[model samples]
Target chain A: MRIIDVHTHPVFMRRGLQRTEIDWLVAHGRALGIERMVTLGDVLLHGRFPTGEQISAINDVTAQVQSWYPDYFVSFCFLNPTLGERHVMSEVERCVTKYGFKGLKLEICNNASDACMKPVMEAARRWNLVVLQHSWSMTNIKQRSFHTDPADTALLARRHPDVKIIMAHLTGCGVRGVLEAKGLPNLYIDTSGGLPDEGLIEYAVEHLGVDHVLYGSDLPGRAATVAIQRVVGARLTPAERKKILYDNSARLLQLN
Target chain B: MLCDVNAFLGSWPFSIVPEYSAPQLADYLAQSGIRRAVVSHLGAVFQPDPMLANRKLLAAVRRTPALAPLPIVNPLLANWREQLTELGANAAVRAVRILPNYHNYALKSRRLDPFMDALAEAKLKLVLTARLEDERHRYFALRVKGVPCKAIAAFLARFPDHHILCTGVPLFDIQNLAEKHANFSSDLSYAENITMMEMLRDKIAPSRLMFGTFAPLVSARAQAAKLTQSPLTAQERKLIYAENARRFFSL
Candidate 1:
């Protein structure tokens, strides 16, 4: 089955940047039936809060990966919105104009509800780019000060109304996270992170609808085989599974 | 054929995973390439007395030949002796499982010394479930953690003769314990990484790792797909699939 992983940190930390490492990743992903991967860059390279320069460096690596295998990779500009409007706007403009990035990658620089995220959302709206946010259930990892919980992402989606939002890590978000993203047409949940727990993918599809579910493997930290199998093995219709595995991401990213 | 070591037959209140009876669980496992399994009951997790759940488990798997009954015994409880006696009478049972995390005890507790001795006396293998569900994603109120690797290591040291199979342990913890102790084996239900098999081969022998799906709570097809799609050799695959389990549980 053809697959498109919408959530991935292709340049995680110091890995997957070198030519050989990138080649290895592409070959491995292709072996597991993934035809395309959305490279979200190394979001944690300079820790949770990165400066504008650091953000550009991360996006540069993302652009480089996309340049290497333009057909196989889709780059998303990594942003730290806590840097305020000017910095956020300039970085997004540079990444979009220069590298042709398709989306904006938001990590734990600040909560998705912070006032500073307004300009970042504006940039996504103005550029017609999707926003993939790093969100988990804040019940356990209580770092809501900078972390974006599923509810926070939902709030961002409710506020924006125009920009698309993808909530990363279905397993980390769990059942409650699915409920939080439910009924929001603009919000999507990615199947990534942690052990591939049974019934979660199916539950997400049931609650969030098939169109709002996206395939993700948080590669390097996780394996594509396990992540893809989670969706393939779910008790979903073939069309539903196809949407989660390939078409949903394809439509969200405009991967014609 | 696959033999799952972590299959269960009871409801976990904190999870939305559908509870399966013996026949239902057997059918589920069969669909995932598991022809046989050493099963336990989830009722033992929350109940003050695991004996009731153990009795229900024994009764549930009584007729299902594909599902081998592995009763959960709480050594901390007063009637552990009776629990052992009842399970021992069943010729189909060759092993018993313990969950220190749920039972509110440590693996190093003095209560386990006698428990280990009793299992030895009964000629039953011990299966230590380090955890059942992923603690991070479980019920918001539940805060139980897995039995520490150091504590499990100390228990293995205390009883060097017993070969205990510890299930639901992470890949890193499994590697850590296997480095110091040789009297333990692990199930692959919770073990994962990009290069899982390649990573484990350096620290532990292939024979020490058995295939466990942690079924119902976790996806059997997804768990089994890892082994079925892995790059392990035929001999290593055989060892993980059925040979290792057959030899370990003495089936």
Candidate 2:
């Protein structure tokens, strides 16, 4: 099966930066039938809140890795939205003009529904970039103030209907997350994080159409074979599997 | 062929996982290259008396040779001796599993001393499950945590002669305990990572590592691919996939 991993950290915690390490990751991913990988920067390198320079350093690492294997890896600009419009705008513009970043990556810098995210979504619209937000179920974790819950992502999608958003971690989002993202046309969910729970992929496809679900491994934390087989092994038709495994992401990220 | 050491035959109460019958589970696992599995019934986890569920497990897998029943026992219960006596009578049963967190008993409890002795005398292998579901995403009301690594270390030290198979342990715990104890083996059901085999190469031997699919609850294909797709030699792969399980359980 042809696959596109929509979320990854090839340079996690400042590791995997060597030329040899980058080549091994490409070979490893290609051996599993992965055609392209969206490289999100080493997101928690400086803890939950990172300074502007720190954010640039992280994105620079992603750019450096993508430069080594440009045809194999895709780059995403990691942004901490709480740094206000000046910083967010400057960083997003720098990444877009300098590195050709295709998407904006938001971690636990702030909740998606918070007022600080206004400029982040605004930048996504101006730059014509898709927004990939770090999201999980906040039922057990009480960090909703800064952490983006699936419901908060849905709210962000509703508020900014013009911008497309990809919510990360289906297993972390659970059953309620699917329902929360049911009718939002601008919102998408990626299969990543935690263990691969049975029936969750089917549940997501049932609630949100097959076109809205994306495949991601959150790698170095999860394996590509495991993530691919979760969708491969789901009870979906060949056409649906084709869409989830490769076609949907290819279309959404304009890889075709 | 892969012999999963952690496949389940009953439903998880909190999720939409398939609760497979013996033959159904066997076929489900077979799709992922798992030809044989050491099976346990989830019904035994919550019921006040586990024998009812244990009896069901014994009968259900009686005709299914691909599956071998691993009954769960609650030593804290008064009739644990009788439970062991009855389970030991069945030749199909090669091991007995215990969930200390779910059964409300600590690993250091005085009750397990006699229970360990009974297991030693009976010659049935012991399987310790550290956690069934991830504690963070488990049912909101179920407030149980995984058995601590320190507790497992103490138990291994306490019974220095017995060899135990531990399921659902994370990679870090497996490494932590491996440095101190040599009497335990861990399943890769929960030890997930991109280069998992490479990470374990320095810390643990292939004989101490085994394949496991937390099936029906977790995806068997996903868990199997974690091992089958990892970087391991043919010999190391054989040891992890089936040979180690055969020598460990005498299958």
Candidate 3:
């Protein structure tokens, strides 16, 4: 089956930046039937609160990866929304204009409910780019001040209905995350993060519908093979599996 | 054939995971290409008396040959010996799993020494569960943490003779423990990454690593795919999939 992984960090902790390493990763992903991989830059390279220059360095590396395998890789401009509107706007424009980033990737720099996200969402809306936010159930992590919980991401989607939001980490968000995303056409959840727990994918599809659920592996930190199998192994019909595995993401990102 | 060392047979109260009957579970696991599994009763994790749950597990899998019962024994309980005796007598029982965190005992506890001694005498293996589910996603009320690696290391050092199989241990913990101790092995139920098996092979000996699906709570197919889909050598695959489990459990 043709698969498009909607969430992945090909360049992590200063690794996979080399041409040979990128080649190996591309080959490895293709071997498992991944046609295209969405590269979320090393978002945590400079820690939670990276300076503007640090953000550029990370995106530069991401842009470099896209440069090498333009056909097989799609880039996302990683942004720390807390960096304020100036940093956020300029970086989004730089990545989109130079690297042709297809989306805006937000990590744990600020909670999705924070006021600072307005400008970030505006940039996504202005550029017509998808916004992929790193999210989990903040019930346990307790870092909701900066960590974007599923509820917070849901709120972000509600506040900005125009921009498409991909709440990353379906397993981390759990059942509550799926319910939070219900009826919100602008919000989607990526099947990434944590273990491929039994029944979660089915639950997500049942609650959020197959079209709103996308396949993601959180790759380098997770396996594409296992992530693909998580959706394939779900009790959904082949058509439903095809949408999650390739069609939904392909259509959402306009990769076709 | 693959032997899963971390599957369960009861309902997880926090989630809507299927509460499968023994035959049903066997069929489900078989669909994931698991020929055999060492299963523990989820009921035992919370019950004051694990024997009741153990009995249920035994009765449920009595006719199912594909499943080998790994009864949970809470060493904190006074009747642990009786529980061990009852479990060890059964030819189908290869190992007894212990949930230290859920049972409210540290791995470094003096209570485990006597229990380890008894296990040695009975010729039954020990499967120490580092965790059952990811701590981040657990129910809000259930505050159990995974068995700490330091405590696990202390246990390994205290009992060098016992070759323990630790299920649900994270990859970093396995790497740390494998570098310092050789008396322990781990199942890959919780170890994940793009290069999961390849990275584990770099740190721990292939013989020390085994296949575990943590099924019912986790997808057996996805966990098995962690091994089946990885770029592992035939020898590594053989060792992880069956040989290691067979030799360790004496199946």
Candidate 1 lDDT by residue in tens digits, B1-251: 99998899998887788889899999988988899999888888888888788889888988898988888888988988988998898888899999888888888788888888889999999999988877776677889888888888898898899998999999899999999999989999998866788778889988998999888788888788778878898988999998999998888
Q: How does model 2 fare in lDDT?
A: 0.91
lDDT of 3 by residue, B71-189 (tens): 99999899899989998888888889999999998887888888999999999889999999999978998999989999999999999999999988998899999999999899999
Chain B vs. true chain B: TM-score per candidate: 0.97, 0.98, 0.98
Measured against the native two-chain assembly using Cα atoms, what DockQ does each of the candidate structures obtain, in the order listed? Answer: 0.58, 0.72, 0.80
Off by over 4 Å in 2: A13-15
Better of 2 and 3 by DockQ: 3
Give the per-residue lDDT of model 2 (tens digit) for B133-228. Answer: 777666778888899999999999999988999999998899888778899899989988887887788798899988997897899998898887
Please report, as a residue range, the 10-residue window in candidate 2 chain A with the lowest summed lDDT. A11-20
In terms of lDDT, which candidate is stronger, 1 or 2? 2
Write the residue-wise lDDT of candidate 2 on A196-255 in tens digits: 999999999999999999999999788888999999999999999989888988888898
Better of 1 and 2 by TM-score: 2
Model 1 scores what on Cα lDDT? 0.88
lDDT of 3 by residue, A120-180 (tens): 9999999999999999999988899999889999999999999999999999999999999
lDDT of 3: 0.91
Question: Which of the CAPRI classes, incorrect, acceptable, medium or high, describes model 2?
Answer: medium
